[model samples]
Target: MRPDSAVSVPDMPAIDLQDVSKTYGSVVALDQVSLRVEAGEWLAVMGPSGSGKTTLVNLAGCLDTPSSGSVWVDGVDVSSFSRRELARFRAEKIGFIFQQFHLVPYLTALENILLAQYFHSLADAAEAMAALERVGMAHRARHLPGQLSGGEQQRVSIARALINDPAIILADEPTGNLDERNEEAVMELLRAAHQAGKTLVMVTHDPTIARYADRRIQLHHGRITDISIFSEDDEREFDQILSKLWTLRENHEPLHDDSLRIAGPLSVGRAIAAMTARGWLCRENGRITLLPPGEKRASDLIRRHRLTELLFSHTFELRNEAELEDQAFKFEHSLSPEATARICAFLGHPRACPHGSPIPQGDCCPAAS
Candidate 1:
């Protein structure tokens, strides 16, 4: 898609690559690639080991710059930003989550998170606590990085990232060092943050994990080679959820909070509360209603969530429903409405979710455009 044609054109993209090309002598690290990611979207950059994934992340995170073309973040073309401006932008709007869990061994988790605040004018203990709480790491706030497990350390890293309240998070192989269980745990935290409206971009070789992204773009020879949308599994899952919602709607059955799972890091109750506060919904007893009576918003949320899970399962070849379901739940909510719609369309308007239920239509997907 043309950069200008992206949804909400004037809105500063969380990250934008315009004909960006990187080369070292005869070796092309990336070639004239263009892409746009809106605020609050999770995009996975995937490719073989040397496919320029890290190069792209470095450029987007402001750690480096493109050899050609332009890179924009939050609407500012940062290709020519002064050194001070680059440092300020990186501190204010971008957070990096490294695979190595680069926490100070001696500092407590709280202190590590607080370290990021030193660059800013406002710093408070409450903000630190809230960041910890957001990552389910509040209980471990006082623990040193050495005392925590790999997963726990990653969580601390995430909490640190949150202290900045950045619009975009750049993670590089965040789960690479952990075992299966730990990997899942770290991913859960990342997913949850994404759902809460943070913009996230991660580099991973694992397709399963990549599936958690609203859009997966592959880089080869330093150029974008493919962009994968939602797949069959995604459609199946959407159909299942839609069926359930429709059943409840038709029977006039109270839409029990327990019956609906938002497929996000936050619980259904939390999701409902947030959406209601934003005027997206209204709830009375067991029944929840879309406040504006618009199907599009609801569909957008559902489709994004389902497609995220589907991508995880398909990319990773994960066959366990419980595993896939857990991953999907956190991923879906991390997507922007525009990215969500693209995923839904890519999946061919799947009638059911992976678990076998109808997928509800949303405003994001217009009727036969």
Candidate 2:
């Protein structure tokens, strides 16, 4: 049997990949990639589909082996590990969050977490329940994956991942399948994990989501292309607040503490305070109103939202109203002005959304069209 105990090394990087490549038949999945992730660092890997983002993650997490070079974790060359050893190493040292959640369909939330423990060590029901409680899913612990909502299932998946107290987390588009509200909730959980000093490596397509990491790297055709360090910013929070304000304006609702329902990581009061400080909005006579800059930003955001709705409804042929709305909400914050303009033009400068409401005119719309 392989060594049952993991040798601990002082001040070692959490993950290190040197000149690693992977090929499936004639197709090269990853091309000579080299990366190092420090302990407690949060790193974002981004690229388009088939760009080797997931492949790189799979190699680092020991879900797959590299075709060449070294794969090291906790200062040990995992490349030399047998399949069984790799499985044990993964259970002991890594936590994973995925877009699809991947919970056992027949298992209750609590049981799923316990299953993870069963693999690493002995199962403990109390510890499992506590893990669920941490993600606000303890009440749903008895429910099976099919009975839980998308967000709840993801919460359960997270609890299971963290139940082992793994040193590293590998999240592949963790929020991809979630709606805006759920996306925010899930991201908040990830932020908590990062703050607690877990080494995080996440694969995401959204720039806003990637900005959450300490640093982000771009991959292209299986090669590293660009790497950027994150700059602290409140742009995401501002966008969300502005989106909420725009909806209130559309519905002719007053912007008050009770009326405003801002979702995501930021609390309602904190979001409002930040907006007030940024001169995006103001409060007088116990009423809040958007300033010019705020108004412009909100209008643009609304335009993007409606455009996204159109893109889904008309282009993608999505028929479910709820799904369309959810997708539109998720995409609005990420769509670039250039892409929005191209979409507007592609749709023949449509004047109305699918719901018979006027789509706010973009600059790309022809005059008098």
Candidate 3:
């Protein structure tokens, strides 16, 4: 589409890439890849070091053009645009969050937000203040980037991103520089942004961060390896509870009043309340026991986890259980019944994980005994 005539379709995807590749010298940053992000969707990109997560984000944000493919943002082919056009398009359509605060050192938090609007057209003090207020940073609007804490600066960055009302937001390791408390606070704002109809693409090394997104994709050696779509809140919640139960069993531990610590960032009291309401857990003699249904659900989780550990070991030859642990957790949470069964058959239903943990026998596996 011509640059002037290009217009976004509310129902169509906000970002789309076809056969995209990015290379630098002899190193390939991203391989042939096609991806689409639906409007209003939150997508998380995850990978280890040098895995091309940032390369993908830079392409999506129009900071760099693909070496051998096409990229469309909001229905326009960005690579076709001139430098001026690309700058204008980004000003109008994209918002960015970075690991560093990247705020002007001398600018007040409120002025920093207005800076983004100034680039796009004209600054509105009312809108700038409102953006900061939305992120709970209004109280510190006059603080300089140097004067604000890391978390506070990040909040200002978020406000700046939203100030322009961009259709798409790309955040790279946004919380990597923050403490745990600040990480949660910033993530809550990102979630709020997603809920407000912005297409969000975030790249991070942390799985906990990925859960906030509606879907997550894993990149490895410049290629997409795994994608998990969390379409239902109930399903993710159930998976979380079941995974926690298996963890307690594996460690031969009993539940405590603070059992939610095992679930990571979840409220122990709230989880217990929900579990009680859902009949997933029952208290007996001060011990939490999974009901029969809960036990059955947790068994599947256990099986998937063991199988995933084996798969990673075989494919990557990980040196130890710790090395395979995160990959196993991600796979276990994302794998479907059908995919789990296929792995069960492919590994000939291994009787044990590398760590000597018994692999539960599923329908596709031979007898455990």
Candidate 4:
């Protein structure tokens, strides 16, 4: 069947995994998983580490076979195909964007775009040019990947992914390495691609990033914990809980049943129940503590909030204390990790927030000089 044949009457899922499971020896990567992605839709996969997000993507992309059960793509059982046939499916029907920006250092931007075509069909320079033009990178077609900045290289990678005009795009943390502006640049391209009818599957840890998709699924220990089509109200509630947890962390206080209830509708009990279920909180002795994953999430939120304060105070020349606080609240949610890192790097990794609390060191911070 043609790749585009995935178009259905809104009832048939584009990709389906029925009772699928994958194991690496004793490690269960995906446990009897089943999922569906509709044609021309965008789906976001989210989970904490070791939650089987990557395994699902690999199986769907035909990069790895499930240990048991079955894998289907575009309504075809992919596990039935031989190795060569699977490779052909990937070449003809899938495009990929990786967080690592996997580009050939020796190839020019134009050459990289043409590389995808060489595998699936003849390499056409005009076709490659059009791909680059779509990504606003036509002028730098002759430049090698190494010659470009992080964002520029990522843009070129986006061009390469589009060269095939694939029906599906699989992106694993596509904005992972990009710093602020570049992350947005790449996401814009992805957003455009989804709008143009490709089925998109992306894995990201950020709720903000996941919000860009039409639906999101959360996984844990190889099981789907929650699947949400997402309403702003739900995201707002989650963000509220995250912020409240950060405040408790800052105070060095163990959260109790009394501590939650940051925003609308979610009661303190419901919040703790939800957070505990997600492995974000542990309740013992009537107090709650954040796990490693929770700490990381809370830390990132704190960084964004404070970094926004820094930007408004200095970059935007805002001086009113109250006004800056309001601005920071508005700016915090949309800031990506890359953007936060850039701000931290640019600010020389300041040790304190505007409130005099110490800022946590992010990966982008230069080693102490």
In model 4, which residue pairs have backbone atoms overlapping below 3 Å? 180-339
lDDT of each: 0.75, 0.85, 0.82, 0.82
Indicate the residue-level lDDT of 54 in model 2.
91
Candidate 4: deviation at residue 52, Å? 3.4
TM-score versus the correct structure, for each prediction = 0.60, 0.65, 0.64, 0.74
lDDT of 1 by residue, 1-369 (tens): 113223443477778899998887888888898989888889988877888999889889887777899999878799887778788889977888999999999989988888787775456788888888887899999999989988889988988876776778999999888876678878888898799778899998765577688887877778787775665554344434444564667567767677786474455665555444333457787677754522444454555666776667667777898888887776765675567667777766665667665566655456754
Candidate closer to the true structure by TM-score (higher is better), 1 or 4: 4
Q: Could you report the Cα RMSD, in angstroms, for every candidate shown?
A: 17.7, 15.2, 17.3, 5.0
Kindly list the per-residue Cα lDDT of model 2 for residues 284-334, writing each as its tens digit.
Answer: 876889987677678777788888899999877999999999988887767
Candidate 4's C-alpha runs over 4 A off are 1-9, 23-28, 47-51, 205-208, 248-254, 273-285, 290-369
Give the local distance difference test score of model 1.
0.75
Residue 7 lDDT, candidate 2, scale 0-100: 48
Across 190-284, the per-residue lDDT of candidate 3 in tens digits comes to: 98889877899999876557768888888889999877664455456656766676777778888555554544344565555545444457876
Best by TM-score: 4
**Candidate 4 lDDT tens digits, 69-173:** 888887789977778989999888788898888999999999998888899888999989988998999999999988998899889988888787787899999
Query: Model 3 clash pairs?
Result: none
